[model samples]
Target chain A: MQETIEKVTKVVKKKRAKFPESYIHDIARAAERHDLDDDELDELVRRVKRAYERAKVEKGEAVGTVAAQSVGEPGTQMTMRTFHYAGVAELNVTLGLPRLIEIVDARKKISTPTMAIYFEDEFKNDEEFVRTIANKIGKSNVNDILQDFHVNFAEMNVVAELDETKIKDKRLDFTDIINRVEKAFKKAQIDNNILSFVPSKSNIRELRLLADKVRDLQISGVKNIGKVVIRKEEDEWVIHTEGSNLGAVLKMEGVDKVRTTTNDIHEVEKVLGIEAARNAIIHEAQRTMDEQGLTVDVRHIMLVADMMTADGSVKSIGRHGISGEKASVLARASFEETGKHLLRASIRGEIDHLTGIIENIIIGQPIPLGTGSVGVVMKHK
Target chain B: MKHEMVPDHAVLSKSESNKVLKKMDIHLEQLPKIKSDDPVAKSIGAKEGDILEITRKSSTAGKFITYRLVKD
Candidate 1:
């Protein structure tokens, strides 16, 4: 009730118009079918009128004061009879439905508040009364209400394209999933065209394999390559000039100053071809999944690997690639020193706390820390 | 009389019950108002100001109570 009042007051202040109580009374009918008692109804009108009065004062024009909620399109909703099925009881609820015509955007929603009251199932064993109630709600609405359990579909976002090829892993492709979704929509005759393609079990397995292959650089380009180093102090940052007469190291923009002790030829080759490696990773990942005849989008593979990889040197799906979040603690413990304290804390921390007792004995009398503050404590529950 | 005009589903509603009683050549003081809070109106899915026709299949002799919705 307060919310409605505030809403009305705000809208009235915005529009700045004045209308008679009857006019305000009419607008308040939007929620009239909510079955509010007289007091609630009166309160709603009072708030609406107050809104108009406020608008009038703010705008300094009595006649021009108007609230945003216009009078009477009442949205074609009318009071009706309904049976609301809840947990264990079926309530014979008086309902109001918006029966008017309007177009709602796929992005928009209209909320209609409702209240259900439980009453005796007087119609029990009374088929005629039951039929009357059903008929009044209409067959179409009944059908809609019955089939309300069907799930919805969401739109798809394509990340990578998969080409049919050979690989070590098998998974379904994305396009194929999209095809299945579109076909489902068509078959179901659902009005919504949007759908979310949830990854299935097989899809996840293939995606994992793809992540491993791409990170290893068995094919495609080098995408997972980290920091590069060069051999000859002069060739470190510079592109390799020892090629079949290509632009060579120093000639490539910003490559002239590479000073490295790590083999310059391989260093420059890897540096100049980082993109090729990344693409190669992408290609391999795609092939791994594609080999299984799965048409999954390549983006998922890339996301998994990128999210998993912290350091490229340790190319692994277990901790380095996909399970990285859980793998770190395990890796540090297994590869390095394990903490006895941590293990003890994990095992007996709760038991230790529970065992420690602090009680007042009065001297041992159990005089405790708060012993001097006996009468200072007051608690109310 | 109103019930005669309406379908068999019509009853002196919570709101219209008094009016119906008056039409039957009786006064609100004479016939029952079927208090707005009566369990009967709830059973027919009628609220204040709404009317419904109920048929009492086996109870109270009457086939049903076509009552108006009221706040009592």
Candidate 2:
């Protein structure tokens, strides 16, 4: 083993390519396993060296442009419609081009916010337990629990008749609903599953406004999470929610916090910080592309994600984010709002160093990329 | 086989991380980054600017060491 290692090291040292130590060790092990003589070992080392040399990226290669083209070209081929989630008919997710645009734009509120919540080990297979957890995570308003709402214009009061069956089905107490409504409106009165709201002054408009407020009042569960559909996948049950409330859902008991993911990027940012948000952008973009049978490299997604979150926050690719905030005045102007950007820069006495690609391109010059990145210096002897 | 079963991951000390940076002749930003919220980064409590050393089992070599900068 020692002799083989020594021969491999000697051959690697002589090679021009800077092969990693692991590669050298690998060659030595393979040579030993084959029981190769000195000549065979040397040939093996040479082949490994050649492969390493071939694998390395060449200097002055326009990587950024290549990455952009690789991603953008396939992006044009992505589907334009929202896709129905697998197994669940009612649940739909914004996929393809719109989703890609949303990710790049770093939009705070997504068109259809969704969450896939997995349960902990104890509650994983228990359908009843999972259903209870889903109910807890789902937002329930007074209108959702109430069967009928009657208005007594003469008395200037609104009466909400609570659904007894729904309250029982959801495992919610009638008093709990009453208490919640009472907290929102002081003049609320409870009588045998009938919650009444009396206006201070007897008026039709005031009664109508009070009734609207009472109808929209959230009685229980996490806010913004409207519907949760629990589906059994193999042995375990997963909760798929229509509305995403990542912050609240994560804190809930029986929830597998680590695996639970939401479609809303900003919600993820708020709950898990900017780094998690960057990951979400990458994961979401890749998933969108993959679902449409488009294959873009993971590194491209990483590069885009890194650029989006480089400033410790998620920023859109276009103006009002990364492009608009460029160091060079001309680069900013060239991206969007050319007149406004140029005017502002001139008024502020800003100078363009012609550093970025866009700025250089606008002035009809070779951009500082590839061969144009460096300038030759003449030496006087 | 045991070593291959579990790849070793460790957080480099401040001085060790600096030495790595010096040896590579690269700034922290130049290194490939891993998010601070990454599972491995979180396990070691690796903050932004911290360097993580991951040693993976290799078939050719006994082990292969790689470094990643933890970023926000």
The CAPRI classification for model 2 reads as incorrect
Model 2 misses residue A300 by how many Å? 1.4
Deviation in Å, model 2, residue A19 alpha carbon: 8.8
Error of 1 at B10 (Å): 79
Q: Give me the runs in candidate 2 sitting further than 4 Å from their true place.
A: A1-49, A82-87, A147-149, A153-156, A359-367, A373-375, A378-381, B1-13, B27-72
Native contacts matched by each model: 0.00, 0.11
Write down the C-alpha DockQ for each prediction.
0.01, 0.15
Candidate 1 docks at the CAPRI level of incorrect
RMSD of 1: 36.0
Give the range where candidate 2 chain A is weakest over 10 consecutive residues by summed lDDT: A80-89
Give the candidate number with the greatest TM-score. 2
Residue lDDT tens for model 2, A1-381? 778777888877776556666776678789888888878877777887778778766887766678789889998898767664644667887888888899899998888889899878998998888887877777788888888898988777898899999987886667777777778888778888888889876788888888888888987778788887888888899999889887777778888876888888887766665556666888888888898889888767877876887665678988888877889998787778989988998899998888878878889999888789889999998
